[model samples]
Target: MAVNKVKKVFGCSECGTEFPRWQGQCSGCKAWNSISELRVSSSPQVTRNDKLSGFSGMLESKIRKLSEIEIEELPRLDSSFDELNRVLGGGFVAGSAVLIGGNPGAGKSTLLLQVACNLSLNETILYVTGEESLQQVAMRADRLNLPKKKLNILSETSINKICDISNQLRPKLIIIDSIQVMYLDDLTSSPGSISQVRESASALTQYAKKNNVIIIMVGHVTKDGSIAGPKVLEHCIDASIMLDISDDSRFRILRSHKNRFGAINELGIFAMTEKGMKEVRNPSAIFLTNKNNNTEGSVISVLWEGTRSLLIELQALVDTSASSIPKRISVGLDQNRLNLMIAILHKHGNIQIYDQDVYVNVVGGVKVSETSIDLCLILALVSSLKNKSLPENLVVFGEVGLGGEIRPVSYGQERVREAFKHGFDIAMMPKANLQKNKPDGLKIIYVDKIEDALSKLIDIIS
Candidate 1:
């Protein structure tokens, strides 16, 4: 009797690159330990299965001419959350796949659950949770003060079961608590594994597109802050929203990393309260503190996140260090850039920061990465070191160069408008940014160099 033989093939879980046998690393995608051993089926594997299937079906099926295909506009479903609607490009588009990612306890589930509850009256909503049990979800729903009716909950980890439920119920909107926890039984890999995440995401994406359903999948981030599992998961989705959690937990910032239907770099602010995540309508009011008087080491800067302008407080501390090597630490701002600015101060302004321990922070636990806040950071540091306070109701923003020249930043008009709306009386910015159609309410002051800005602020300080 002859014995049957079987062959195993190794492939990358991310890019689907196949190898003859099991390997320690994937050469195609340069991912470590991503090679998984898969049983090679008797049928030959086709490289272009998805393309061939889609294209061949299009050709063989009843051919509809371009003009013959019906053109219909689908209205977006209102999420009842203004900030979410704005980030989602005028609300959630039907048949769209949105991937929301954040750290643990960043309120990803809370945000989605609240949205589902809010839309329950008009549309049938399904909330699937793989990470949490039904009791856990129910407790949260109760805390949110959501009504029990019309909101369906399913605590399942199997992707097949979830899809089956989706088909049976045919909900208007579907929310998957997390993609990492969903698993396909056909795949031998464990849940949240690279292979499982990729395969599960692909299946759900296909199901969503075929059924014309709006699906929102929550994903976990890696230790390095990148989305966990395969990169193709992100590519297959329609939009990706990244949530940033502050140490204080009072505020959470939602930013759009990718949007096929809307603008990029859009930001949505939410406050984590007992009632769940509540939208912050007026961020400037909450962000702008210390209205009574101006103090040293604190300066207001108008920063633009997407189309919205936020008034942020930039605070710095410069003091003598006990150690031989003085420390340069920054929170919510780039440390390297802070060091470079200090170097420029030492070189051009005859100020020595090398012997001082410098620290910088953006107030309200918000992160400001734009270079427009550079001038404000420098001025705040200088004022703190000299024990001098800036003038009241004054805000400053500009990009500082190594040669001590001030460079213009984007969306100057929007920043100025926000400053004016926040009752800021004066604005100091780059001279190049002073253009036509200036904002009517505030006093716009432009400067060409760091020295010029300091000179103007010095008079007010005295």
Candidate 2:
């Protein structure tokens, strides 16, 4: 009989790429000093890997033609929260493993508890909390006035025991309070280690698929906002959603980073209250408030978020630089893109602000990522530079190219309709976005070049 030997290898914590030896840098993710040691067996014998192959006994992999495969629509489990469902692209798919990550005190537990309570009424749900004790969870549920009769709660850190109980209970969903604290007894390393976290998540995901159960795992994020643990943890899960909240705000933004079952980059809004997390159904209304008293730099723009259209307020401030080098700061927007937009303003719009400091902000703490906000941002910059306040009823959105041409963005018609519905009187956009069947009462200004837009702004402001 041949003896089984152990092989020590190095792995990148950022990307989970394995290496034969330790190195200062990870070649996979190009991260500095992220390589860590990992040990595995080099045995020829069939082990747990064979069990997780998702095959039955005496059966081998078979090749099937794509035309022969049957396509069936699977019924999704509704969490009863419209905001969450919207972000999830409908509902949670059966047998899918979802990872929700957030900073500490971002209402991750509160949100999940509320969801589990609402979902427990219809189906069997298991909430396994490894970080908190049963009493703590119970106290929170009671304080939040949530239904607790049907929800099964388990305080376990051992993944094996959790799986054993789950197998017997045969729940429709399993909620792991956190994956970092979960550990396998077979592994000698401590819990929260890279190996433990990766293995534990993999095992839970495999179990979810094999048993047709939904597993929702809560993950902690590092200071840089990336999920804690090997990046492979994200790759193995079906969906990775993030709950974001600022220190001074009570609002929480739930967005998807990865989703195999639905659309990605979907945004959901919620407000944390004394009772629990309440869904913000009309997020656009909440974000568009108090615009009547608009300032010199304030501008309203429409953002295409996931499947819906959102009206956002953009504010920019330009002032003389106090330091030798002017500061270009942006909040709730991309900093690098702010610099590029400033350069475009100088070259195309003929508004030079190289020596002045520029600051831009998106109201309501919503991050604007779409390029459609480019025209709106440029207009806001010009408005601030000239100390001119744009009309509160005017909405602007279009992409500005380096050559000073205003480009059309996606879903222009929908954006225009959303602006019109919000009582905006004027819409400044690219000529390409002009609709044959325009909104009835609103005025649409089609500007093809940056100079034309500046002139229009002057006309509207004057």
Candidate 3:
């Protein structure tokens, strides 16, 4: 008989990489001062096999050809919100684990509660709250006017008891109000610790996959807006979704960072209302609200997100620098990319803003990550420097290369059509993106080089 023993190890909170002892820097994530100690008991081999069997559902393993396996289509549970479905790559898949992270007041709970109420109408659903009490959840549900008759509520922090209750209930969907507070009895580490978080998430994910249950776990975010806990928690889940509050507190954006069933970097827009979270069907229109016509340094660009296109405004401000080292500040845009765009404008467009305080922003607090906005940003900077406003109804989008060539972006036709639907009169883009038949009311201006685009802009503005 072997005696149980305890061992101490260190792990990185950011990446969940383990080390034999303490280290100043985590080699896995390269994070400094993030290493923490964890004590874990050496359980018997039988205990390990029991957990493994719960995941694999097999006592013995055999090898077979991949082609010999048959494929089956698993139906998804629609959350009744189109935006949420789109971000989730259609809907919640069976036997899938999804992690939703957000700041405290970002409305993560409200969104999930709304979804759970809607989903409970058709299927058996279990709502487990470890952070909030049952009465608190019930009050919120009543305040939101959500249907609560069908949903089953449970308040538990122990993973073992949760699984036990799940076994009896056999709910099709189980929602963990939060993962950080959940603990496993076998682990000596406290809840929310690195060891507890990683193991709890792993166990839940395995249980989800093995039992063909859809489990959506709410996770807390760090100050930096990243999901709190070991990075392995994200890896074990089928999808990692984040809910963020826009610059306008009234709106929220749901983004999918990883998805096994659908596209990555997908975005879903929502509005916080008195009743609950409402999906923003037309995000472009909402983002372009309250526009001041003929404003210098302001331009509209067509951005392609996930499977759709959006018309977003880009604004730039160029002023004489007061300090020797000019400030290069950007809001809702990458700082390094701003620097690169400035360099491109200087070398290719022949505009020198190196001495000026350059500030760029995407209107409406929408963070634009695609490179398609490069030309729009640079042109906005030029418009600001010269104090000449671009056309009020013009939409511009194209990538700028180091060699000064205007490169076409993906889904150019879709972008053009989206812009045209919004009543944009002029569309300035790369020549390569020139379609055979332009929209009825939209004029297409195709430019081959950065200078050509500027010259054509002069032609249009004149």
- Please report the candidate that would top lDDT against the real structure: 3
Rank ordering of all candidates by TM-score, starting from the highest: 3, 2, 1
lDDT of 3 at 394: 94
lDDT of candidate 3 over 284-343, digit per residue (tens): 999899678999999999998899888888999999999999999999999988999899
Model 2 lDDT per residue over 120-169, tens place: 99899999998898999999999999999999999999988898898789
- What TM value does model 3 have? 0.96
Q: What is the lDDT of candidate 2?
A: 0.88
lDDT of each: 0.82, 0.88, 0.89
**How does each model score on TM-score?**
0.86, 0.94, 0.96
Superposition error at 193 for model 2 (Å): 1.4
lDDT assessment of candidate 1: 0.82
Stretches of candidate 3 exceeding 4 Å from the true structure: 1-6, 42-46, 49-59
Clashing pairs in 1: none
lDDT of candidate 1 over 1-462, digit per residue (tens) = 543344567767667787998778788988887777765324333132232123211325675689987788756999899999878878887878899999998999998988998888788899998888899989988888987588888888887788778879999899998998897766555687666787777777766766778889999998877788778899888899988886557889888989988887788889999999989999888876544365778889998887788998888888999999999989989898899889877776677778889988887777777899888888888888898888768899999999999999999878888788878878889999985877666788899887887788777788
Ranking by lDDT: 3, 2, 1
Better of 2 and 3 by lDDT: 3
Residue 260 of model 2 has an lDDT of 89
